[model samples]
Target chain A: MELSLCNISYSVPGKRILQNINESFKPGRFYGIIGPNGVGKSTLLKLLSGIEKPEQGEARLDGRDISAIPRKELARDVAVLQQGGLAPVGFTVKEIVRMGRFPYQSWLGGESVDPEPLINEALESMGLTGLQHRRLHQLSGGERQRVALAKLMVQQPRILLLDEPTTYLDIGYQLQLLDNVRAWQKSEGLLVIAVLHDLNLAAMYADELIALHEGKVLARGVPDAVLQPDLIETMYETRATIIRHPELDVPQVMLAPGVIKSNGLLSRSLEAHVRRL
Target chain B: MLLLAVSITASLSMGSAGLSFADVWGILLHQLPWMPDADTIWSRGEVAIVMQVRLSRVLLAVLVGACLALAGTGFQGVLRNPLADPYTLGVASGSSVGAAFLILFGFQLAIGVWTIPIVAFLTGIATLLGVIALSRSNGVMQIQTLILSGVILQSFLGAFVSLMVSMSEGVVNQILFWIMGSLAMRGWEHVTMLLPFLLIGLVILIAYSGTMNLFVLGERQAAHLGVRVERTKLIVLVASTLLTAAAVSVSGVIGFVGLVVPHMIRLIVGPDYRYITPLSAIAGGIFLLWADTLARTALSPKELPLGVVTALVGAPFFAYLLHRRMKDQRGEE
Candidate 1:
């Protein structure tokens, strides 16, 4: 399924959060939205996932307006994993994953989607089989993220909207999470969109990148096209150097803190810059 | 199942006017000749009191307890708070004030005995609707705002009830008896009046058990899963409030069963409302039946208030549960 946002605009009472945002997501690809804090990256994802209605815009699943579809039908097509998805107290990892079946189950006298196989598969795919029975509070940060991912995996939605899924993870876990998502996308033909903060990580893993600054799409394309050194510096307001990875040939960024002007005087600030870089 | 059966049998047998298991069975099976018969053997007056009066009281106790517990579980699940009870959201106080007002004033208008309960039910539903309307904004009910509004409404209604009770002349004993709660005058008529409401409430609660599970994950998450969060909440609040109103109108402020039974079930079975709801209903019925039995038998010829018995049992257990939960939180930290 192709997910497209057509001329989307969203605003709160006092401020506009997104303006005429046009984007389309393709299946079997890992897409990333990169931006600073408060840039409405999460809001855009919410619009696409049908969690929040866009103002003066339309999100289409195939050719049909997603907003016109019933919520249950839309829920089957798209799953959103928000950063705030905390398990209630005493909820086991398995129980949390089983909740993914909520959309599939009816109110009364309807059989739940056979959850055992899906739960087992999700736990194994996320490398959380051993921790299935563990309470969510007992898990480490990385383990909890994996449990959250496992829940979304069991949902088996065509489009996955993830907001800062790797915020609390270490570097190793981050890579592992992205790799696991990539593997699932390949096998399941899923459209995966994630909001990420680390530019280098986004460039390395995302098939396509949409960079946002101040609630507007500053740049969007493949990693090489969007992760340019000048674009990074301009968007983030910091000097940066872009280099190709030795093995993968993907663009990698290194900040260049070249100089400092203190009290309108230029000094040899390269040492401090280098340390930070 | 065996435990439930044994509890039912015990409930049938034990009361103020004592009937042995055999006599109770004979009463139940009127055709059985071998069963020890009791026709003026235990005094015709006492037999009528036991078979007609206490049996209905026990049945009503079980029904009210089950209703409260079921409603409590739904309320906690929908609100996503373990501390939430059927009465926590002001429905009880609102119903109390409504019942009290009708009792004190409706006598002058020549309203019958049923006017108080009817007024109480309508007022409870109206208060709940008002709370829901006031707390809702842009199709969202902020949990904290709803809780705060409920607290304020409860205080207001409590004051109203107090004022009515204080100003009433020659009805002090009636008011006190109603407030303290008793199973003394509860008979088949009271049981008949509550049965339909209890059944309706239980059916509604059980029907929404799946949605209640989603509700425990919080509103946004439940809504994202297509659970129609606002409608579900409204249905739950109205239904639970109606259940509580019916129970309170008949029994008059039987506390703690609504608060304690659901929490205990959640602690044992986890937060799956599908299981928690039914288990709470059954366990609640058994608990109140036992409490009523103790109320009658604890002191011969001087029955304790049913509410007092429930508090005596529920308060320490609730404290222990809270302490354990705190310890668990500490351990987690």
Candidate 2:
């Protein structure tokens, strides 16, 4: 399935978050949306998920406007992993994961197919089998994210929109999560779009990068093409050094001394340079 | 279920008339048309007390309790706030005001006993509409705004009820009993009024249990999970409001049964509304049956207000729950 945002514009009163943004995504690939905070990356995901409609233009699925699709029908093929994952409500791991079949279930809670196998596989994938009966709050942040990932797996949508799925994870959990997602994308031929704060992790896992800045598409291409030092500096307002990985052909971003300090200095000097011209 | 059954039996047999269990059962069995012709073992007065009075009162308690509890579950689930209930949303007050107006003006006979409950149902719906209308901004209702709207309408209507009551001359005592709530003289008609709404509301709540569980993750997550968030919200609101209004109309503004019963069920059931909804109904029946029984028997003929009994018991339990939650939150941090 193909998902594309066509001339999408969204704004709150007195502010424009996204303006005339255009992007498209394809199956069997991982697309990383990267930008500084408050740049509408999550908003883009919300539009694509059909949770929030754009003020102008549309998000289309398989060449059909997503808004025209009923929410349950749309959910059959599209799933969104929300930001910060689940809260500490009293639902157990298995119970929450079982809810992935909600769109397929009737109001009477009957599903046509046996979801047990799918649920079992998802639980095992996240290593949540033992903790299936444990309440969400009892789990650690990383565990909760994994539980969330387990839920997404059971949802088994062709298109996955992730909003900072790893916000609260440590480095080890982060790599573990991306590895599982990467493996699933390769094995299942699913389209995955993630809003990633960690550019290096995005370069490692994402097949392509869609760089967003100030609610506009700054660049979209392979990670190697998009993660250039100049683009990084322009997008983040900080001087960054991009170096090739010693073992693989992906670029890693290393910020200059004092990331915040360099951000101020570079932005100030860039302003001065523009003034001089 | 057993507890509920036992409570019902106990309530019927232990009314002020002091009928025995055997006599109560014999009276009930004798009333059934299917029973073979049998000699009357109980007196006319005893039969009247059992069949006409206590039987209907017990059934009304069960129905009203179930109604309030189911409505409470809906409110808590849709709002994603554990503190949310019929009273919290001002829906109970909305219906209360309608009954108060009807009684203050002696309009009770205009439509018979049906007048107060019918009017109450309409005003409850109207209050919900008002809350939903005012809560919305830019065609969306944020949780904070929805809750704030409920609070505002609740206090506003509460004062309005007070004003109307103060304005009345002779009916002040009557309105007070209704507002404070009682099942003292309620009959089979009151039972019939709440029964259909309870069944329909229970089904609606159960069907939406999945959506309500999703809502615990917050509205956006539920929407992302294929729920038509606004539609779900509106439907649950209307269905539950139907329950609260009908219940308040029939039984007056019974306090804390709605609030305390569902919360207690959630604690046992771990917040799954499928379990919470049905279980709260049965448990709520037991709760209010006993509370009403206490209201009847505790103070003898004086009959302490049913709402007062509930509040007396429920207030401390509510306080404990708040304290425990505060401690739990602090512990989590």
Candidate 3:
């Protein structure tokens, strides 16, 4: 594992979000963190990405504590993509992607060699070649997300942290985005940790799936081992049926409504069902 | 740049005394040591008026305009607010308090021409520091906190200014006129005081323009991209505030130029601060030069306030730009 979360815990004022979470992320593998709303999957991603500091423990990159590394040095190796992607800045797609070279560029925005070739490569891979000169606000939802990924690719980071990157996308976009990310992760040998809300998509894309519940890791293993129906039911307190994909051999989650109760009557309030769990 | 030069030349010739453009050019050329002696050709009084008085005032207009506009661009970028201007940090109110204190107390330092502007400069810097100190917690400056502190200080200092205004006997109208903002009778002293700050602030802002591009992603994303968020924010705030304070001290309180000029430039050049900052400086200088000329010539013997001229032109121009942009968006859609 290139990045390790050692006994990480974080809390804000009265609310404890993440508690005693431990995980190791190796290079060349995609890890999906799955949890219900407010379970601190996003918080954990923040810690690992070095955007936030843990309250009780340390996030280590290599053998060094992450906090000890200067921000620019860490930036050269780690990149984070947040939900909603980047705001619609009035910059062209090429200009926005060029900004990812911020860590390597000088004060006057000069690079050693011309960065246009590298930027072009990133744009080509993200399928943004035709949109290079287009302004960010002019792009569609999927296009903007791809532009954001192109920017991250230009940064050339070894570790990628994505926080609900596909939250606002449709099912097709979600799959397309994940497919692109998986391809990039394999090609670059990147350690990709993503906070994914869609369990089916997460199980399909991620090499390992970590199930978090109430600030703790309920299960952590390969998709087939951790994406079980019982684990999903216990963690989320929702009835779910899990079955392996016929070709892919990865478990997929199917919501089985009102199946938790013997009478097959769905509870009107989720809080009541959660209390029962 | 050509427009600015033309405006400056026109302004040099348009005072109460009628000097033609040729006379203005000749008089300006005569002052340069490298040029052939044209001093004897023009009258001494004309030479003095064109070179010393009118030239200084026009240069001061350019300096103050450039500084305010550049500061405005920096503030808008860092705060991520389209409405933010150079004066959003309470520099105007603080300088007003300083000028009011000077006028009411009749405290005349031996600093001669430096008296009012110097006091205002010191007070403006103090106000900025106080706002930053109040807003920053754990060395991180929160945008909302900074704006709130500025508003609070403005109100607080505004009360002091009102008290001083009420207490003053003589110099009341003078203080009021000064506060209204003007570039009248400004000499090389104002230019000297403003130059260093403008140069230094521009250098700092230009150097950081690239990092400013990342700011549109918001603070967290900027940091994730390797910008030392707090450090960059502090430097930009200080540098831009320096530009603002320097302009406010010399010019009293010129509004609208700082707020509208950047937007005007952004409309032409897009929102990249790297291009916006330099272009805003040039356009701002030209804008204020023309406005100042209009202010001086519009009433001939009696000069209108510089601030009024800028607002009159700026408000209508800004409205037109907004309308055009909306139309463009409609077209795009």
Candidate 4:
């Protein structure tokens, strides 16, 4: 399956959030969308998920306009994992994940295929088997995210749209989540698009990076091609240095401190340039 | 189910008129078509009092209880708030105004037998429509707007009821009784009035229980999960409003049953509406049957308002739940 946004534009009353944005995603790849806050990365994801329609142009699934698809039919092919996740209001992990089969459920709660085996497999794969019976609120942030992912796994969507899935997690949990997502994407041959705040992690996990700025696509390419220091600085309005990772050979970004200096010393230091070795 | 059976038996046997369990059962059994009328033991007056009056009231109480609880479950799910109930849309206040208008002004009935409840039902529907209209902005009915409109309409309609009552002396207590809510003198007429609406509304709500569960996750998530969010919201709102209006028309705006019954059921069986809606109906029937029994029998002849009995039991339980939630938050922090 192929998902693509065609000249998509979205706006709220006085503000334009996305502007004539066009991007296409292919299956069996992880695409990271990176930008500073409030740049319509989430809006773009919403459009792709068919949660929100674009004011102009269209989001298409395999050349068919997404809006033309019924919500239930569309849900069978696409799943979205939202940021900050959902507040677990006493729904057990199993119960929450079981809801993934809702699109397949009838008004009488009958499903075409049994959901139990799929739910169990998802629980096992996400390492949520132990916590399956526990209420969502009782679990830690990372554990909750895993349960949410397990829900998406049970949904069996070919396209996964993740909006900052690792927002509140610590470093360990962050890698763990991204690793699981990446592994699942490969195994399932799924198209995974994630809006990531951390450029380094985005560069590391995503097969290709699409950097968004001011509601427009700034650059779209392989992480090594897109993660240049100049583009990062220009997009973020901050000075940053990029270097190759010692082991993985991917570009990693490190921001220069005091880039937003109020003092004269830091301003003067910006004038000094070091010669290339 | 057993509790409901026990409650109905208790309700039948123990009212203001003292009757033994055997006599109550015999009266009921004798009323069945298969039983011979010649074999009936009770007097004409006793039969009329037991079968027609008390039995009908019990059935009405059960229907109203179930209706309110079903409405409560729908409202809470649609609003995604635990505090939301059947009366949250100010339908009670609107019905009160309708009944008060009939009583204070001595309005002549053109509808023959179905005067007060019909007026109240129509007014309740009108009030709900007004609230819905007031809340819609750009065709979207925001939750905050709906709740605010309900509050505003309640205050507005309540003032009218008060003004109407103040103008008439003889009907002031009568109007006050309506406002406080009662199941007194309710019969097969009231039961028939609520039956169709309850059956239809319960079917719609129960059928949409899966969608309601998704709705509890919030609108956007629900939409993403294959629910037609706006359509589902409108359907649930209409169905719940019908359930509430039907109950209020017959029972005169009984409070706390709608608010407390669903919460009690949710505590026992998780928050799944599929289980909650039907279970709430049965549980609510049991609850109100007992509450009404206490209302009429607790002081022998002097009957308490059904609303007062529910509020007395429900208010403290609501406070305890709120306090426990706060303590739980503190513990989590």
Candidate 5:
């Protein structure tokens, strides 16, 4: 499956959140979209996932415009996990996961037996087998993210859109979530696109990276090429060092705290550097 | 199911015109050979009072209870609020105003006994439609705003009803009886009046059970899952209100059943509407059947108001549930 965004722009009232932007995602790859706050990373993901229509552009799944497909049909092709998926009171982990099968089930036919097998498989893969019956509110943030992932897994969509799925998790759970996603993408040849705040995590897990700034694509390519220290420092307005992982040879970013100075000296230099970049 | 059957049978047998189970069944079977089966042994008056009078009233109680509960379930689901009931949208108050108006002015205009209920039903539907239209913005209906509007409308219409009642002289008892609600004089005409709306409402509500489940996740989430959120809500609101109107048309205003039954069912059997809708129908029927039976027997021949019975039972239970839920939240925190 391939997801391509063409000249996508989004504006609210007088302010443009996203400018004309273009990006494409392909199967069997983990793509990370990263940016600072208020950069429209979430908006771009929403556009790609068909949650929000682009104001002046279009997103295509294969050759078909996503807007042209019915929502139910589109849901079967793409699964989106929004940040902190709210668990309505009383929803069990398994029931939450089962909602992914909404596009497949009929009103009276009940849930598909096939989806049950798939849900069980997803739960087992995420190590949620013992917690299937647990209420979502009872789970820790990491476990909830896993449950969300399990939901997407049951969806079995060709394209997966995740928005800051690990924002609330500890480092270990973050790695565990990314690892599980990567494994599933490998085995199933799924297209995984995630919005991540942690550059190092993105560098570690993403096969490719797209950096969005002010709703436009700033840089996109292989993670190694996109995660350069100069790009990170320029985008984030901070000093950073980019290094290679000892074993995997992936880019690893190490940030240096801004040098504090009176009279706004440090911030001005950072601003000037960003402008120069 | 068995309990429902037992309650129905008991409701039929235990009225003022006393008939044993066998006698009730015999009357139902029409097994008596002679006309009125020896008038002295079994008075025609007793048989007439029991079979013709009480049976229809019992059926009306069951039907109205089912309608109110079904509408309540639908409203609660659509609003995503457990506190919502059939009358939360002001249908009951609006209908009361319409009925009161008819009693004060229209009855002397030579309309039939059925005219007021019909007018009340129409006014209820109109009021709901107005609320829906008012609350809509950017194709979305804000449930909280809708509820607030309903509360305001209810208060306004309630004032109108009170004003009409105060001004009217001869119709005071009639107006009071309607306001208090009853299953006393309801017959086949009332049954026929409510049956269609109830059936249609049930079908529409049941059809949207899956969407209701999605809705509980929130409107945006349901929309993402391919639910036509606004359209579904309109259908649910209109249908549920129509059910409330129909029930109110037949038997004045029966409160609390709608608010309490669905909530209780939710506690017993998770929040799934598929289970909740049908279970609420049966449970509500059983509830009102017993409540009406108590109304008939608790005070002997002089019956208590059906609405009073429901309030007496439901209000305490609702308060307890609210307290318990609050405590659970505190414990969790």
Candidate 6:
């Protein structure tokens, strides 16, 4: 089995974050996890990435317990892109990307195989070659996030996990970022499990979608089956309209958002928002 | 290496005795076994001053500076706080209390002059343990909790030291002067005492310098990047704490060098720990060497405190660098 969870359960001091999660993720495919906030999406990612131990069950990769795998070996197999992206430290773009080769380096930072070509290639792919010498603080948030992605690209992990990596990007750049990741996932024959807020993007990119609700897997199937309007509404507790994409064979979601006052006049804020639109 | 050698030679020559560089070099070279003992022209008095007095103190200053800087770099790297230094946890203050307690009770020279330094070193280590014990919870030491715990220990120990200082009216002058810090008359003993810690800490830091770079992203990212975060942090923390304690034991609380030297290195060399770690040690050595030289020779016979010299020179220089960096960032943006 690839990275798989067997009856995983996690809890904080007074709250249960995840409960009885049993899922086996295979390589050579992309999976998207969608849920509302506080539904344990990131927590599950942490468990799979071996950063967090499940309270009840164990996460396993390749038939062995994930936590039992030495960190460097595990890192060589898995790379995680944390939520909010990397912070603005003073490292240059090249330096940050080069760090992705840590698992392959020696105590004195000597790598048996030269990583310069790989780092240079990753930088080129992310459109960061021009800013390779610039410090992280000098880059905008979108550029910083791209730098993080470039770092992971050089890592060449078998499993790439992302948590809201699109938070800082504009729509154009978000599509560009995902397109790069998707291309890499296909070419490298790796697995991509991303916790995504944008249901449409999840539907477009993920081969399979896992919908988490209240710390459990509510649905798991092809996007077409998982993204049904009733299931989306049940998971998010908000009305959503689902339609097949005109250009792609995927379901897209449109928020059907409104609130009614007792007097039945459009709320002052909604009227103002409509007027501005 | 060549610069450190030159700086050490220059410092050895220019004391209140006013010897030249050639005289200093001759005095130093004359002691070499292969060099002709009869070829030495320096007087016994000059030799004594250079070999016994200035050479030892200058080397001590170099060792102390390098230790502080190395320790500071490790602290800043692991804690991911630019403001962290050897003194951040008040180990120096804790050490001072030990030294002061012994001095006030007239037990400083009871077991010879070495007793105070030994006691100070013990207390410094004890304080580190206390900080670690306080900060750690559920086998996890978060950065904020660690820093807060350090601050708590520092203020408490600082108050304890003040109380001791107030109670000892007779030896208060000695305690205060020593606490202000001096590298005076420290012979081979203090140099040898601090040497092993510096060498060991430097070696450990070099091996882990790669992981230190990941620390800038934070502990969580460092773990994800395959660093054994808890193991690395604890080993680095203990090593740096010992380095700081050894330095403090010999030289008292010589502040500012540890706090500013690493930042200066970061500004010049950028944030790669591989470079920052070694560069900080060397730069700290050079900075403290000169500061000590100025401290001894600036006022000549009076010999100003080394701590005052470091703060006076370091603060202004650091302020200038900071101002320039901020302005550069603004201009670039």
Best by lDDT: 6
Q: Look at candidate 2 and give me any clashing residue pairs.
A: none
lDDT of 6 at A107: 79
Instruction: Name the best candidate (by TM-score).
Output: 6
TM-score of candidate 3 versus the correct structure, residues matched by position: 0.94
Q: Which ten residues in a row have the lowest lDDT in candidate 5 chain B?
A: B31-40
Candidate number that wins on TM-score, 5 or 6: 6
**After superposition, which runs of candidate 2 have C-alpha atoms over 4 Å from their true positions?**
A258-277, B37-39, B317-333
Instruction: Please state the error at residue A192 of candidate 6 in Å.
Output: 0.9
TM-score of every model versus the real structure: 0.90, 0.94, 0.94, 0.94, 0.89, 0.95
lDDT of 2 by residue, B1-333 (tens): 988877887789996678788887777787779974334577788888877888899889988889998888898888877788887778878988888888888898798768887888889888989988998876787778888989999999999999999999888999888889899777888887788889999988988887888888888777777889998998998898888988888888998888888888776567788889899889888888888989999979789999999999888987787688778768866
Residue-wise lDDT of candidate 1 within B234-321, one digit each (tens)? 8888788888888887887888899899988877787777888789888888888888878877896888888999999988987898
Query: TM-score of chain A, model 3?
Result: 0.92
Higher-scoring candidate on DockQ, 4 or 6: 6
> What local lDDT score does residue A105 receive in model 5, on the 0 to 100 scale?
76
Q: Please write out the lDDT profile of model 2 over residues A1-277, one tens digit for every residue.
A: 9999999999988678998987789999999999999889988898898877899999999999998899988888998887788898788999999988888888788888999999999999889999999889888888888888888788789998889888888899989888888887898899999999999999988999999987789999999999998898788767889889888889999987754554777788799578546
- Docking quality (DockQ) of candidate 1: 0.45
Estimate, for each residue in B1-333, the C-alpha lDDT of model 6 and write its tens digit: 788898999888787788899888887887888887623576778888887788888889899999999999999889988789998877898899899899889999888989989999999999989988988887888888888888988889888889989998988888988898899868898888889889999999988888988988988788888888989999889889999999999888898999999999888988888899999899899999999999988888888888999999999999999999999888987
Clash tally for model 1: 0
- DockQ-derived CAPRI band for the predicted complex in model 5: acceptable
**Candidate scoring better on lDDT of 1 and 6:** 6
Interface RMSD of each: 1.8, 0.9, 1.0, 0.9, 1.8, 0.8
RMSD of 1: 5.2
